[model samples]
Every structure is written in structure tokens, then in C-alpha cells.
Target: MAEDAIVVDESLGSETLLDLRSLSVTYQTDQGPVPAVRGVDLTVRRGEVVGVAGESGCGKSTLASTVLRLQPATATVTGEVLVSGADVITMRWGELRALRWAGASIVFQGALHALNPVQSVGAQIGEPIRIHEPGIEDSEVTARISELLQQVGLSPSRAAMYPHQLSGGQRQRVMIAMALACRPALIVADEPTTALDVMVQAQVLGVLEKLVKDLDVGMMIISHDLSVLASSCDRIVVMYAGRVVEEGPAHAVFDRALHPYTAALSAAFPRVGDPAARFAPAGLAGDPPDPTSRPPGCSFAPRCPLAIEACREAEPELREIEPGRWAACIRVGEP
Candidate 1:
């Protein structure tokens, strides 16, 4: 198993499980091409949990979907997306389909909608196993499904129930079980705990954390909730206006944010026991920029409290502000 390092060097043998180099996704719209993700360079090593956190429409989901080539036919994807050293973008259709579960799988949000309403949870969990490993025996598939359900903190019997019959948390657990059926090296969990109550969210996250660790699988968890990421992820990458603004160790990004956007995001989620944070939670003043009509220069400059004349002239590149930490603000190293 790989060591529990938040940042792993790309030079470190084959530890890099997922590598995105200058990855971008643009959707064809009636008006024009809308860029949902732009020049995103990220890597996830084995046995690491990386979190992507941002506000709605910030392209968190787009980045996640693009990794698996799950985007729509109208969307245009460019650049390299390497999963287990295989380029997903150029892979043939047959290879891509075969890679879906065995290479990487997604636990999408809204499990109620993601799962078939009429199918039993056990069947849903076993579907991927049967599809990817067609020669597996029926009895073995049934046993694997039951074992997965139990691993996710659900009773094996619960697998017989339909999606509608399960609670929100139970449905999310089923989604996790389905993702694990293939034992893929990487898992992208997009808002895995969405719509669940606070207690249930914690429970689901705990199960996810345990599974990722015990299986030594790389994981990329996308959520609008910084607190959720901070609690469960080893590192956090902050995205805004379809670009990464900052990334660092989760505790550092949550407690000592460098970029204005990341700082605002961290403050938006107040600490439970902190009296000051509860009373005066910080908030960003404006909505994200339109994808098709992104303004010149920094996309976030219009709403950035510390924006200066230089910020309006060009978009800042993501530069290392500290060792193993990156931020896209020109003022990051300023006094």
C-alpha cells in the first residue's frame, strides 16, 4: 500500500493514479462555446483523498464528469486525462466503456435519480460486476453484492429493498457499494452526501473514508461544502470561475487560506464551537462569472475584495505560494 502523503511527487514511480494535464471542457451552446473547466492540472496518487470544493456552477461537477468521459455528446473535451497511465480522452469507445467500472467509477449525487427506481438495490450493486466480469457466477455476484452492502454499514438484507424504500443515507450507501463492486483504483464521489441530514452526512462520509483507506484507492470527492471536504479529505483544491484558485493541505486551506476566494469559501462554513465564526460568517458578494462571457483578466476580480488594477489586466497563473501549495492570486505573496 502507498504511504498516507497528502502530496505525492509525479516522479515517484507509478504512484500517480489520476493525472489531468491542462484539461478543459467546453459545451456547445446556442450562443457560443461555454467553457465549464479550463486548464485544470491535477493529480491523485494512490491511497490519497483529494477534495474539490467550490460554489455552485464552479465546474466542480464538470471536472469530475470529464475525468470519466461521462460528459454529453455536445461537450468538447481537450488535453490529457490519464487514469492508471491510460489516456481516457483518446481511448476507443470499447476501451472507454470497459474502463468505466474497472478503471474508475463515480458515485453520483442524487442517488434516488442515479439508481433505477424499480430495480432492487442488490441488483443495482451487482450490475457493474456482472457487466465488467461477465464470466462471474451468479452466486458469486450475489455474495459480492451482499458483502458490499454490509461493508458500507448496511444490512445485507437491505440489498433486497428498492431505492424508494431506503432512507436517503441508505441510498447513498448503496451508491458507494455499487462504485466499489469493481474495486477500481480510483473513485470520484460527486456530492456523495448531498441532501442527507447532518448526522447522516457524517455517517456516510465516515464510511467513505474508511473504505478509501482500507482499500488503498485514490479518491476525488467534489462538494460545495468546504467543511465536509476539510473533515474527510487529506488535501483540498479550491475552484472558482472554472479555474483552480488554490490548493493545499486541507487543514491549511481551511484554516489559513491564501486566495481571497478560498478564504471566503472557508469562512462561509462556520466552525461549530467557534463563537466568532458562528456570529460573523463571511460571504462572497457576487455570483460566479458567466462561462460564455467571462470577463477579461481575472474571472474573480469583479468580486475580489483585494482586487487591484493589475488583476483586471490578465488572469493569474496558479503559482506555488509555498512549498507543496498553490494559489492563483497575484497578491498571494504580497504583504
Candidate 2:
């Protein structure tokens, strides 16, 4: 599929920004090698919000960590991750550190723990600017921090408060503000609304939506909330057991999914503007195969509703089924 697509709605702008090719991350445990993120390729474009949606243990966060190279010591990462035409996986440590803030940044999960309780939010946000461009004066750094706080919808006055002083949504905005301090070209948000109250989730997601529109920054939003992904992202990549099962335009993927896993996830959500029509969320029976001992064929075959003889004997590669849609299911496009 093309990196750039024509904007269906004239109101939103579109362009290509970051791309990942065959990105895979594995870890060596006593049992054996466990693949956390297996052969997943994703893209986020300028002025576009891309959603990576999957259930818990679906490797959504692992994929995000691999994108940022935030892994444990025993982890082995292999694949191409390109940001602004530069391969992240191959960069030297010095190069990687230099690329972090200006090229891309991350709003990781567990913000309460990510932020230091001792320091103020303003100092945390100013750290990047100060470290990266030491020549910039203190006044400029302070002004930039305030602007970032305002951009993420946090009150400028709240910058002086420590993380413990703010609510969940406010803390999340602080994380986002810190990620945006250096005006990054891309942002990776992993479960940005995981533990927030329902009311707070709506408000935080609104701020994220506005960030994409106003800052023109490419975003990779990792979440299991289909409703949020459907509303916030331009495209969706559905991950299953460490692999991408389906990917396409957000609405099209949700409405007309190809893979059985994608279909099950779609069936689990309530459609917008159709609250009166209720249906049980289609649950995929059984569990995803143990990553330590995945099956010979498709990893999802054990739990798939439509598993067949071939599905149990041969793995399928992700391939484009249409001009812009890709799926890893053998049954897709078959009569």
C-alpha cells in the first residue's frame, strides 16, 4: 500500500511520516526464544493518527517498546524501523539518543511511575530542551515548556506542580507535554488512557485528537478500545499474538475486516449511532497459543472460529488483499 493516500475528507490533511518494515522483537528466556512482536510492519503519516488495536497480551505494548528500543537486557530486536528515512534499529547509541527528542518521542504507559515524584513537571519537560540544545537561553526553555503544557491542554500554572499533585488525565497530559517538548516529528502513545475514569478518558482523548490536528505530528496510538481507535485514528492495525492480522483505513477495517481475528474483535464493539441494536460481543474461544510454544501453522488457529485443515498446517504471510488493505488470513478473498 502507498505510504500517502488521498484524503477522503477535504477537511483533514495527509502525508507520509514514519514506516516500519518486518519489525520483530524476541526475548531469550529459560524456556526458549519468545517472540513478543513478530514481523509487524506499521506506518504513521504526517498529520495522521494511526491506531494499533489488540487485546491484552496482544503484543501492542511490545510493538511500541520495540519502536523506541525500550527493552530489557535479554531482549533481541531485529527488523527495520525507519523514522524520517533513518533506520532506528541500526543507529549508534549516540545517534539514537540524539534522534529521540527531535525525530520522535514516546508517551509510555504508567505515567505516574514514569514521572519522578520529586521534580516538577516543568523541569521534566525542560530537561529535553536543555540537554539537546544547551545554547538555548533559560527564558526560551521556560517559554517552550509553558507552550507545550498549553498545547496538551494542561494549565500553564500546573507546570510547577509535581506528578503526585495532579489527577490521572492531568498527569497523562504532562507526559504528552514532555514528549512534545522538543517538537518531535512523531509520537508513540501506549495505552494513554488505561487507568483513567470514563469521564477523564473522554477529556484526555479529546486533547490527543486536537494534538494530531493542530501540531501536524504523526502518532501511533496503542489501545484495545475500539471505540477510541475508531473515533481518533485515521488507520488501524490489528495485532494478534505478536503479528498483524489486518490493517487498513480505520472505518473500513472495522466495518469490513478480512481476518477472522479482526472480525471477532470488530464484532465485540458497539457500532456508533446504533446503540439500540445490541449484540453479544463475539468472544474468541480458547486462548492465544503460548508464545513459548506457538503452533506450526497460524498462531491463532487454536482459538480461531474458522480454523480449517490448511490453517492448522501452514502459516500465511501478511499480503495485500486490496489496494490499501492487508490481511494474514488464507481464507480472505476466497470464494
Candidate 3:
């Protein structure tokens, strides 16, 4: 019954960079406490790209925000968030500040809004370097900014432009440039491709994958798009109603998902050229349950096509039905 027992993969080895053990987050609202994430256990090894996929309100964004202690003051967090063996939840303010850009950084969605309207892109990117490595010379910081801009496929001259001057894709590149400025060991990208055109999305994603591979940085990419994750991540974790219901290698989880929720999600996003899927893409029948008033047994039972009496009566713990894949369903191995 221990929370950590639900983790699927055991061969992550010693280079595990980010470890989340029984991590939970609850917001103290006027109505009552609303749980956004619940008893989740996850691990991201060095040089690995792990994707957390779910619908908009399924707590993927909350999980990404909580990893860096960016959740609001009204939210109460539990359990551990270890970044390179250090516990972030218990770190002091000074320690957390230092950890923010140096140890780990986030590439948030909506680059147009995340960036300061008044500041130049160069100044924004330089801000992290100045804060994290205080004693570095101005010349060196400027040089680093240029390097980062180029790294993300933007011209060094683009640094002098304000956020409003750049295209959506260019602005996103600026965000990526800022994230890489500190050279953090881990990067959490929350819906990084949101609101961009298809071609632009591919470009931005390509930049992220290249940087992570080139720098050997561990990345946690959170997105509602299973196709995006399947194309970019090594492993994928599927969450429903604030809990991870299925997880495994990207190919297995996306192509042959074991959990009904995961299957529904994958089916919802069909390939562009696939005629069969394009004509009649599958969609889930109902909306996700209300997080504040989630049902007792399986949170997904009400909508699961394969749900049975057992699913409606008792929540199933995440269990490994295959060698490296796990699913939380009573009929995991059954036809």
C-alpha cells in the first residue's frame, strides 16, 4: 500500500536525476481543499526525456509547477521532489532561489506572456546568468546570451528585440534560450508547443530535443498531446483525475496502451496521413471528473469502456502487467 510501490520502472540505475516520491499537491480553496496531484511516484534519469500526458485539468501542469516549487502559496505540497538528489520541498528560500535556474528551470507555455513586454530578449536571458552566477563579467554574460540564442535557433541580433517584435515561434525560442542560460541539469517544459502552428510546433520541439540530447540534460515535457510526447519522449506517463493510471516506454504506451484512459487519449489524436484514423478519430464519451469531488473507486471508471463492477467499487493500484509497463486497472492482463 506504500506509495512508492506503485512505480513501474526499476532499472533507472544510479543516474536518476529527478525523483518524485509520493508527491501530492492540494489547493486550500474556500469550498475545501482540492487535490490536484495525488500520491504520484516518478523518476527521470540523466539524459532521458519523460513526458507526462493528460487532458487539460488532469494535473499535468500542477505536477510540472510543483516540481520547481512554483505552486501558489494557497497550495500545500506533500512528499519529496528530488532534483539531482536534493529535496526541493524542504529547501530554504535562498537555496530554492539558487536551485531555480542553476539546478532546474522551466520553459513555460505562452512565451508571449511569460516574457516581459518591456525588456529585450537579451536582457531577459541575461537575467538568469546575472542572478545565478553573480560574479561573472558583463561581457561574459552577453557572450553566453549570444550562445544561448544561437543554440535555440535564433539569431544573436534577435536578442535586442522586445517580446512583441518576435513571431510566436521566435518568442518560444527566446524562452528556450532563457531556460538554457543557466545550463540547468533538468528542464520542465509545460505544454511548450501550445498555440503554435503545426510547422512551428515541430521546429520548437526539434530545438528542445536537440538541446536535451546535446547537453545530456534530463527533461520532463508535460503536454496533452500524446502524439507530441510519442514523437519526443523516451517514456510517457498517463494521468487521469490527478493520478497516474498508466506508464511505460513511449512506443508501448502510445501504440499499444494497456489502460483504457490512455487508449482513449491516444485514439483521440490520430496521425495526419492515416486515412482510417483521419476519417473517424476516437473520442472519449464524457468529460473528466471534478477533481474536488472525485469518485471513490477508480476516478476513470465512469468513462472507461472496459469498466466493470470491480472498477466501480475499488481503485486499482498501479501494477506491472508487462516487463516495463504498468497500468492501474482490474482487467490489465485480461482480454
Candidate 4:
């Protein structure tokens, strides 16, 4: 329900809900301008779940924040972030505010920290409804809160509890409930399963997967764990040093990763029943380049096991290899 001026592009054809066209974000620090996200293009179609996987400080979080123009003033953002075809960067303040909960919503990680310790869970969930729908009766707000709670696998009775009173998984479910309160078309979940046990993580992901299918909404789940994305997402995009190194169908990328970074990440997490992987988990050595002083060639060349002199000459462009599969490495097909 953004302003009238913010209209959906007919070219998007109603399927693509969120699109990032060559998006980049740079933060101005005392040290210098640090490029957090660089020339990344991504999309999320209706009823599809897309996952963005990368290590800490690899710009996954920054990319999520930029979806709604949530980046700080010190950060310089470029390129288009089109949610339903409206550019978030160009929207007016009023339009942006209206677009937030109704058009798109975010489920931030660390539910304990994101929620209000003082407010009841119901109050927190109802707050967005009240702000977005002031004319709605208080009784109706309460009813909507209960429905959202039920949808996320939590009892309606749990609404009265505070954040501190709920378990970690319960708190995370509450966060999901809040994100669903407005029934937005798009949901950006930033590390939704972080800090939870494996069992709890599975529960949370199940909830998310079910909701996305039932509601027919597009979701982008960001995380450092490739396994989580592999299990939940339709497509997986692997990022390294502020750029996407490889992207493809979830199973293809997880089972046979083209990029060394993606392969290393996938191997880092052991499979439940795979004997060979159970005994020895792969470890990726070396650190990412400093943002302020990134090398001219491939940023990952220094740490790449298969790096050649050609890889150090210039940065490789992301190109389609086979059908929908894409990789930025010059030596993608090389054995």
C-alpha cells in the first residue's frame, strides 16, 4: 500500500516481487570508504524462497538492509532496489513508511534483542497493525495477533508473555508472527535460525517454508550456513568479498559448487550420515581482503587453491555457465 505515485512495473509481470539491479553499498568510515556490497544483482519471485549465503562481514546483512533503504546515512548506496517495481532508494519518506509493513517486512536475527523486553508479545505484534491501520478497532487488532501467532505454530495464549519469558525458539516464532502481522508480499529474514539448536533450527525453517508456500509470498533468507539455505531455498547465491561468486539451484550449488568459496563453505558443515565428512570437516584458510584496499584482480585469488596467474590479472565477471547456473570464476569449467 505505498503511495499512488509508487506503481508496480508491468514489465515485472507480477511474478518477480523483489529485484536488485547492480546494487552496491559502501560505508564511509574514519579509515576510508569500505565497499560492503558490490555490483550484486538478485531477485525473488512470488512463492519462491531465495537464500543469500556468505561469511561474516561479507555484506549479506548490508544487502538485506538496503532492500528497504534501511542503510545508515554514512553508507553510500547505489543501483536499484525494486520491491514490486518501485525503487526504494527514490521513494519519499511517507511512501517508504507506508511500504514498510504492508508492502514488505523483515524478520531480524536475535529476536531477544529485536523485541521489546518491557512490552508483551501481543502488544509488539499489534503495534504495527495499529500504526498501519489506525481505523481498525482494538478488538480486531487482538484477533489478528492471535491468528498470526497460530500461523507461526505458537499458541494464542503465548501472546501475553514477554520476550524474556519465552524460550529462544518461541521468541523466534514470535518474530515470524510479527513479520506476518501485516501480510506483506515480501519477507527478508536475516539469519532467522542463528543461535538456535539444530533441532530448533529445523523447526523454525519448517515454519518459514510452510508459511512461504501457504501464503504465496517471496522470501529472502540470509545466513552464513550454506546447509540451511540448501535445505530451505529454491535458489542459492554464494557471496565472497562483497560480490556473488556463484549462484544456481539450491541442490546443484550445494552438491556440486562451482566456486571454491562455495565448495569450502558447503564442506565446512558436516552431513548427518556422511561417514567421510563426519570425521574431518573442511577448513577454509586465510581471511577476506580489507574492503578499503581490495586487490585489482579476484579478491579471493589469494586464498584460492586453484588460483592461476590469469585470476590475478583482473576481476572476473559473473556469467551464465549452464542454463541458470552462474559463476564469476574464470576457471569455472577447469578440472
lDDT values for all models: 0.91, 0.84, 0.90, 0.91
TM-score of each: 0.96, 0.92, 0.95, 0.95
Give, for candidate 3, the lowest lDDT window spanning 10 residues.
Answer: 1-10
lDDT of 4 by residue, 1-335 (tens): 11110123233454888999999999999998999999999998887788999999999999999988899999999999999999999899999999997899999999999999999999999999998988999899999999999999999999899999999999999999999998999999999999799899999999999998789899999999999998898889999989999998888899899988899999999987899998999989988888899988999999999899999999999989897799999999876
C-alpha RMSD values across all candidates: 2.0, 2.9, 4.1, 5.0
TM-score of 3: 0.95
Q: How does candidate 2 score on lDDT?
A: 0.84
TM-score of 1: 0.96
List model 3 lDDT by residue over 1-335, tens digit each: 11121232244443778999999999999999999999999998777889999999898899999878999999999999998899999999998999998999999999999999999999999999999988999999889999999999988999899999999999999999899999999999999998799999999999999887799898999999999999898889999888999999887798899999999999998777889998889999989999878887999998988888888888899999988799999888987
Model 3 lDDT on a 0 to 1 scale: 0.90
Question: In each prediction, how many residue pairs overlap at the backbone (N, C-alpha, C within less than 3 A)?
Answer: 0, 0, 0, 0
Best by TM-score: 1
Per-residue alpha-carbon lDDT of candidate 1 for residues 28-118, written as tens digits (9 for 90 to 100): 9899899999999999888888999999999999999987898999889999999999999999999999999888999999899999999
- 124-212 in candidate 2: lDDT tens per residue? 99999998897999999889998999888877899799999999889998998999888888999999988788798888888888887
Clashing pairs in 1: none
